[model samples]
Target: MEKYVPEKDERAPSAADTTALPTSSNERTPSMILEDLSDSGRPATEEEIKTLRHVTDQIPLRVWLVAIIAAAERFTYWSTQVTWQNYIQYRPDDEIPGILGLGQATAVTVNNAFNVVVYLLPLIIGPIADGKLGRYRTLQICTAFYLAGTCILLGCSTTPAVEAGAALPGFVVALCLTSIGLGGVQTVTTPLIADQYDETVAKIAYRKNGERVVIDRDMTIHYVYSIYYWMANAASLGMILTSLLEKYISFWGAYTLTTGVLLLSVFILWFGKPYFVLCAPSGTVIPRAFRVLWIATTSKFKLDAALPEKQLECGHEVPWDARFVKDIGSGLMAVKVCLAWPILRLCVGITSSNSIAQAGQMQTGGVPNDLLMASNAIALVLIGLVVENGLYPFLEKHRIPFREMARIATGLFFMAVSMAYGMIVQALIYKAPPCYNFPLECQGSDGRIITEPNHINVLVQLPLYILVAVSEVFAFVTGSAYAYKKAPPNMKSVLQSFYASMSGVGYLLAVALGPASKNPGLVVLWGSVTGVMGLTAMDNGQTRKDPVWHGPFAHDVPNSISAFMSQYSALSLIRGLTSRTCTYELKGVNFAYLPLARPHAVENSQPSQKALSPGLSDPASDNVHDRPSGTLDIPEGYISTGNYIPNHNIVPTSALR
Candidate 1:
């Protein structure tokens, strides 16, 4: 067995080379030959570059698999939710209100509770996936849980012997399981994509990555969040069909159908596993340190690390200075201010004023109300896509900053208009008599129940969707992007959860306020007030925090403070807020969710001296012993090195000294 050594001048043999030499001891030593090859300088040619580019163009198959799985999971989630209330509310006329209310209440509670888990899971799952099971396996485990939950729901729906109460528990359990799955999927898949490809490749492949490189995990997760939400809605579109199918078939049939889709997702993920690069989990040291630091500041716990060593000045490390803690406290105060301002405005302008107005409209047929509610979802889907992919691009091209405050301002304005639209519809409904003498209702020959006509009321409220849509485009999308960009790298997943948490807070507020006001006029009035406050905040250059005093005592506080703070903070934050620059830049960059099309040209053309062949001999050395040995040993009739010398083709001594 001869030792083999790589040579520098091994000039990659051309296709024309076709001769092989028998191994002999007299040949130059492989080490000497390797030394010669190391000294030889050769630049890569055009062909190599082209070959490299070709390889780089093909994205790994794993990305598509992950995407497909994500899409399927979303579809199943949405399909169930859209009609779950309707399905559960089915009852006789007498039991309708109680059953419907109970179902709605249960669903809402479950949604909120599940969200807590969903939000918190990322905090732990990110570190776990990065350190323990690896991304693919973790996703697989979560998928299994999701599938199990679907099966449980299917069984409960199918078993006639099971009481509704009993079945309800099963449904809750299933929801919990599915929520875990959702969290796991949310935590792992997006980060995995970011890990596999470089910045350039990601940009060309994923629309989100085109403008940014080295994005915070949060930003990457935002794209996943949007995609996941859309998938859920897309699945919901199947609800009508599922409901009809339940009428004709069985409830289990619908669930089973969804399960099948989930299984297909699992299959895709399994097959594509080979293409993903599993990132090793970060050790316990960094994460534990973060946890300690967070606790120390938030709970006033003492730090475990030594004072001098613990104080990290580099923005990347955990800051341990007492001032840093103060800054954090100030930041929290700012957030409190931000959260309170909007609520106060909404309470005064909309909730307090519109209670009776909303009640009056509710007295009319509920079709218009349903339409108004439905319009938000419709607008979210259409307008979100349009603004994110279409409008934002156009704006970016024209150099619009698309700042967070600008978006929040725009969204609040539209939201106010939406409330106003509702108010106008309410007024029309109020003017119409309970039994309008429109001959159209009584003209029917069949003795059918005649309901009040409120066509005018419904028709006028359609523009509310436009307002909601436009607001969502600015508030939700931009807010999400901003959150992810600003979040620290280690906290990417947690940061994404924070974005979800904000929306959760918004939903909670909506639910809380639903019963607070009984007049529609008041609601519209409060909405207008909030809209103005938002606008004032933007104009004054206030950051996210600018408190809006709420509560019964809110009237005591002068608007002057709110106005002054909003203007001053806006200017100060806009001028001095260097912290957000990185985030803003991230929003500009593009990221690819899928793998690169192929291996990059640069990677492939950069010669690995190991791959080259050894030359016949050195030209400068008259001493024959110093001559290089290895030669292009292509056998006659072979395009490549197809077994010219059995298992041991090139003698090790021939390629090196």
Candidate 2:
């Protein structure tokens, strides 16, 4: 590691300068080189080495409580979403009655636009959670919004409200409120759940089988997310009940029950307040992060130049420390990792809107049109259980490295497979009907056009839903784990929001495809999405293997290389500027005094021993008079008089005063 010492120059003193301040013994300095564990402690014994295996730590009960809150929220949110296509497309006169008589195109468009709002609002709410309101309080407010929205939705869905023509307007307002609430809930929920278990290092532990294993925090986090997602999917089963309610009763009955569940989540959150590991809002964190990035950018992306001492040496003032810069690096890395998510989101998004419409156009028999959507939840629960409890443990026990990025890539590939299947299914649907290319526009025997669905069984859509579930088990869970683990503590919500925002972007893309979502163009839409997913999956895999990606949250280049390159490039540029600079025209500048100086050397006087070790200083020796004459007097707080200035043309502080 290189030590950064601020240069003595003709510059004004800055409050941000830490050169005069002594470093605390407890303060951890940033290190570039990876720590060598070879000499860290005593070598493991032969028996210990042979029996050692990585295992997860026991998740706290409080974590489960948080997961339950998320599950309940998902339950209510998805329950409303699963019924959206049906509610918007069909009417009471249709076999499967619906509230709004909008066509399939309008329904898919509405669903896509709703998703856009649902995922986009997180960007606004994330900063609020990290700054003004804590995660717990923000979540409470969001639940209120959600409950209010659900109530309005129920009110507008009544037969009288539909007859009175207020359903469309009321649906719009309800969706807007629900989107805001759900977006805010999603932004903070996962991050809050992750906050409960803060152990980062792996510790050795003994299992009930009398086997010694390393309790890996990373693996534990992975497991937590898996089970968390499992519960989320389990709650998604609420959509099945909502669908049934919509069929047997009315849309009002279904939404009324969902509102109650959302209310229960509120109570659960309130009771768990005492147990939750609540972190207070650091109001200035996001702004400070932006300022750090501004500094780094202005300094030509030389991050170290944004450091306090470096900024001071360059005659600039700054408010952050080196750690803040490191955190910025971590945050940027998280953003970079999520760049591939939009395509994946585009693929998975088909299920919520287009796939529901696709299934609705097929022969559903007595099944509700959107009821097949529950297959995704069911498959996710089954797959999550098998993968989390079975496959993950087996891999860990055998030391198989199925890292987060790899899992994400695998998930992407699975999504591609599902999309490919969807493209084929659409083609099959087009080919299987009496109407052929136009199933909804079939001509009856009397020469009148019949608008009936095709003869393809909706059950064939099962594989598509199941594959998407498998993909979620791999991609969505691991991507979240990657984001949560990479983000700095204060910026957890922001990073998670960044991750979630990809889904919004994907939904926005889906909105663009609204025109093609109907009829013969559906095949082309599915093919295009499948192609994009495949390409992104390949790109993600290549990124994982790329040496440029040092670690999950490191910079594009290795830290050591980035620092060295920045410093070398900066020094070279400075040397070029100094070599050519000879004169500057002064216009109306007042100078109190200009001092003529020459270099003074204290022969055979070694520098202070403290200079060898950065971030360490002896306070007793931190005095202006403690050093030889002509040496810079750097002391605590104030800049001492007679400090050496490298440029003689500039006036000394004492002379100027």
Candidate 3:
């Protein structure tokens, strides 16, 4: 203490105030301080940066392990599905009717219905995982169900004298179990990736501070999804070989092989649990609000008083907490907005196109259709990589606003064109002989072949895949991004389910068209309808202000003030009629007269100047009122008032103000 040289002036240090610090005879500061600052200020060397990146960028090893498990699971599922109908038809000595077509159509229909549950369960399962079971544990339970289903399927195949009647029930049970398990797997895997890079610094570090990082999660998800597809193909290829082997080998051999693969998938997921970051479910406010909104929309009560105050799970008041209610209501409201346009008529056309495609595939036996299906998956994998890594970066660098809605519209147009091309191909193929011989060999009691050649019907349908692929580049990838961005964070699973539902709707339309196509004129009529719809979609896409709803009721009148008012005014002026006949008669009269009004308002109005301005600002007075209005002036050269800014030449706002 006695030897201290006034302790370096005993004050807080400053950049310019180092006067009391000890210095060498040359007047330089100590080397240690200089070195410390130099170390802090200098950019990291290449080797140092690389090392940092390696440590930070690591994805939990478990993700890769889970990916493998998922791939294997998909392999087992598709392997069974690809050959299921054929297996059922070939079962020993069974004289099944020409119902193979009916069976295939039924399978697709049943699959569509099952998908609603498959998709909807994730909503409930996600919470159960977060609240009751952990992610890893939930995976374990689901894996067991998947394994059990496979085992049951194998057992059912072995059962002697398994009549078609008995096999149906067994197959349905196995499908449901497998679907439920896979649904759980999907729900759990998505959240696991999110947990791995939950920290902001970790996300940034993993992204290497690059734009590519934003898509890193999706790339990883899809990469894992692609691996599953590849495994599925491998399994399918093996099954085809097995089908050939059936001439020399027992059916048990093929069943045993599939069972072994499924078991291995189970083992892989079980052992690799330790490396994953098992995230505890955090209480999310958004989900609570969503529940309230869902109830409001689906229930019979009014929006404000939809749920009783006592029943409101979210602590906040009903209307206040329901932010999504407005968005969803607005989206529904926008349905009417679409109905006013001629484009609304296009839904019928689009529905018809989807139906014809479906019915055509079914009638031709779904093999060519399956090949076309493969193209969509292939396109999805390629486009996801290209757009994420190539096109997006180019656009961003050039300051282009590649709006999500525009991307979706572009995709839909491609899809529409694909449908048209498919119809053209079908027209050509209608002149060729049927490709498959089995259908022609089966004869009716009159000794006439039950199925006759319709032409090279299957081959011409191949182009539909290319069209599907192009449409997917715009639809699937862009829609995935849009939904993920627009959906409330907690509703990711719900959004995925919603996306899957679109396919269900497509299938339903196909089923409906199958019966309708018995009349030859109906097929032509439907094609024309779809063509017009496609053209309308193209026109609306180019000129419309808002994105068009592509869902089931896309062309329906919105349930809004104008629609209600129109209906109310159209009602008969007669006083109360107590008789049931009178009420029925009145209902019939109302339907005949009341045409629901379409919404004319583009969107909800914004706050006017009077509402936004703080104090009175009279233009009549010469004195300029300088009250704190908080109203920002519209900067020169800016045209629109939305959140996004347009790219145009404009003076700096600071300079003008």
Q: Whole-model Cα lDDT per candidate?
A: 0.44, 0.71, 0.43
**What is the TM-score (0 to 1) of candidate 1?**
0.53
By TM-score rank, best first, the candidates go: 2, 3, 1
Best-matching candidate per lDDT: 2
Q: What is the C-alpha RMSD of each candidate to the true structure, in Å?
A: 20.7, 17.9, 15.9
Model 1 local distance difference test score:
0.44
What lDDT tens digits, residue by residue, belong to model 2 across residues 1-657?
Answer: 011121222122222321232255554221101121122112344343334555666788889988998998999988988898889988878756787878778888888888888888888899899988999899999988988999999999888998999899999999988988999999999899988887755554433322334555667787788778989999999999999999999998899989988888889877778888898998848778888777777776766566788878989777777787777776766676687777777776776788988887799988888899899999999998888878767654433335555566678778888999999988988988677777766788999876678889999999999999998998899889878877888899999988889889988888887777778688989999999887776556223111121111123322321332211121222232222211111111111111122223322233444433332233554322234344432211122223332221233344444
Per-residue alpha-carbon lDDT of candidate 3 for residues 163-281, written as tens digits (9 for 90 to 100): 44445566667778877787777666554544444333212121211111111333334333333333333443444443333323544455566778778767776676666666555
lDDT head-to-head 2 vs 3, winner:
2
Better of 1 and 3 by lDDT: 1
Candidate 3 weakest lDDT stretch, 10 residues: 586-595
TM-score of each: 0.53, 0.75, 0.56
